[model samples]
Target: MTASLPVAPDARQKPVIAVVGPTGTGKSDLAIALAQRLGGECINADSMQFYRGMDIGTAKLAEDEMGGVPHHLLDILDVTDEASVAVFQRQARELFDEVRARGNYPILVGGSGLYVRAALDHLEFPDTDPAVRARLEAELQERGRGVLHARLAELDPASAQRVNDDRRLVRALEVIEVTGRPFSSFMPVRQYVQPAIQIGLNGPRELLHERLHQRVVKMAEVGLLNEVAELETRGLRQGKTASRAIGYREFLKVLDSQRGVLQEEYSVADAITDTVVATRQFARRQITWFSADERVRWIDFTDPASLSHALRAVTDA
Candidate 1:
C-alpha cells in the first residue's frame, strides 16, 4: 500500500496532500485513493463532518468506504458543540505531526474553505471577548445580519466582503471590537505553514448541479430526516452551528410543520428542494474560495485520468 512518491532531494519533511473541491465532486473518494496508494492517513477538514450523528446529510464516509485507511478528526464533536476553526487548526496540525511521525503522509480533505486554509496556511485567529461576542450576537438577532454586515463594512471592508454568514459576520465584528484592529488583519496569507500540495477537483457546472441534486435526493431517500430527527432529540436545535447546517435546518422546519408549530405545510420534498438550492449555492461559494488560491492544482472530476494526475502531482512534488 505504501508506494513511494518523489520528494525534493533536500526536502526536510513529507508534503501534506490536500484534496479539496466543492461537494459531490468526489474529494473524499480521491483522498481515500491517495491514502491507500501512499500509505497515508486522511484528516477530515470538512467542518460539518466533525459532528456525530450527522452522517446521512453530510455524506460522511461509511466505515467500508474508508478503504481501510486510517481517518482522523471525524465524529469528534457532538451535535451541541460549536465547531471552531481555531480549535480545528490546532487539532489538525497535531494529527499531521502524529501521522508523519508514523511514517505516513497526512492527507487533508474537505470542501470547508476556511478550515482548509487554517490547516495549510499562515492563519492566526484573534482572541474573543465573551461579552463582545454576546453583544454582537444580540445585535445580530435584533438588527439582523444586513445591519451588522453593514457595520462590518464600515469598520473592515475586506472582512465584510469575505464573510457570507451571520456567525462569521459576528466573529469579525467581535474581533475588531476586541483587538481594536480590523478583522481582516487576521485573515490568512497564501503562504503555507509547511510543505504541502493541494489537489482540487472540479467539473462542468451543469454536471455538478445535476450531481448535487441527485446527492440531495439520495440523502432524503436514505433517511436524512430520520437522522435529523434523532439529532434534534440530542439538542441539535440548540446548537448554534449544528442547527444552521443546510439540510438539518431545512428538515427542522419540516419537523416543525409536522408538529403544527410553523402552521405551514412543509413536506420532505419541499425540504429537499430547499436543500438542493442551498447546497448548490454553498458549492459555488466553495469554488470561488478554492479557485482564488493559485497553489491548488486543478483536476477535472469527470476526467478518468484524475487519479493518475493526482498521483503524479504528489510523486513529482
Candidate 2:
C-alpha cells in the first residue's frame, strides 16, 4: 500500500472519488452506477448505516441495488457497539488501500461529512479519556444534551456551529473535555492521500423537503416501525449514538407508547411525520457542511441533465 501511494509525480493519482450529499439525493443509485462504469467499489461512510439490522431508516443499499459491484463497511457493527469516527477512519483506510491494491477506484459514499473528510484526510484523533466521558454522560443524564451544547458553545463555538442539538454536540464536548483542546482546533488537515475530485449533490430546498417527506412516507409503508421495534428488543436506549439517529429517535416515541412506557398516546403515524421534519433539517445541515468544502463540484440533483454533465466532469477529471 505504501509503495503504491507515491509511484509517480505528475501523473494523476488513481482517483478515490467521494459521492457526498444530503439524504434523499439519490447518492446510492449514482454511486452504484459510477462504480459499475469506473471500476470502483463503494466504502460506506454514513455513521448510522454501519449498524447491523438498521436498513429502512438509514436507506441502506439493497442486494439488487449493488449491481454486482463490491461494497465495504456496511452493517459491520452491532447496535450494542459504538462506531466512532476514529474507528471508521482506520477501517476505511484499510479498505481504501485494499481497493487500490485490486486496481479499482474507491468511492466513499454518504452524507456523514465528518467520516468522509476524516477518512479522506487520514485523520488520527487523540485518545479519549474515560473519566471525561463518564462525567459528560452523568451530566447528560442529570441535565440533558442541551447542557453539553451549552458547554460546547462556551468552550468551542466553531465546533458547536457544526454540531446539532443532539449526540453530535455531546461528542464534541467529550472530545474537548478529554483532549483539553477545542475539538475544532485538533482537526486533522488533508495529508498523505490520493488526489481526486469530489462531487456534492444539490436540489432546490423546496424540492428536497418534498423528497424527504415522500421518503419518510415510503419508509413507513416499508415497515420502518417494525425495524425500530426489533432494535428496541435489543435494548437500544435513547442515550446511545444509534438511538440518536433521525429515524430511530422518532420511532422510539411510538415504541414507548406501545410498550406502555410513555403516558402520551403517540402513534406510528405521528412518529413518521416527526421523522420527516427531522430528516429535512438534517439534510439542510448536510448541505451546509458540504458547501464548506470548496473542492466539491456541486450538481443540481433535480435536473437529470445536470447530473449527466457532472458525471462527465468526474470522468474527464
Best by TM-score: 1
Q: Give the per-residue lDDT of model 1 (tens digit) for 124-179.
A: 98998999999999988998888998898999999888999888998998998899
lDDT of 2 by residue, 245-280 (tens): 898888988878888999889997898888988898
C-alpha lDDT of residue 90 in model 2 = 79
Give each model's whole-structure lDDT.
Answer: 0.92, 0.81
What TM-score, computed on C-alpha atoms, does each candidate reach?
Answer: 0.85, 0.80
State the displacement of the C-alpha of residue 221, model 2, in Å, after optimal TM-score superposition: 0.9
Regions of model 2 farther than 4 Å from truth: 1-12, 131-185, 190-192
Candidate 1: stretches off by over 4 Å? 1-12, 132-184
- Model 1: how far is 294 from its true place, Å? 0.8
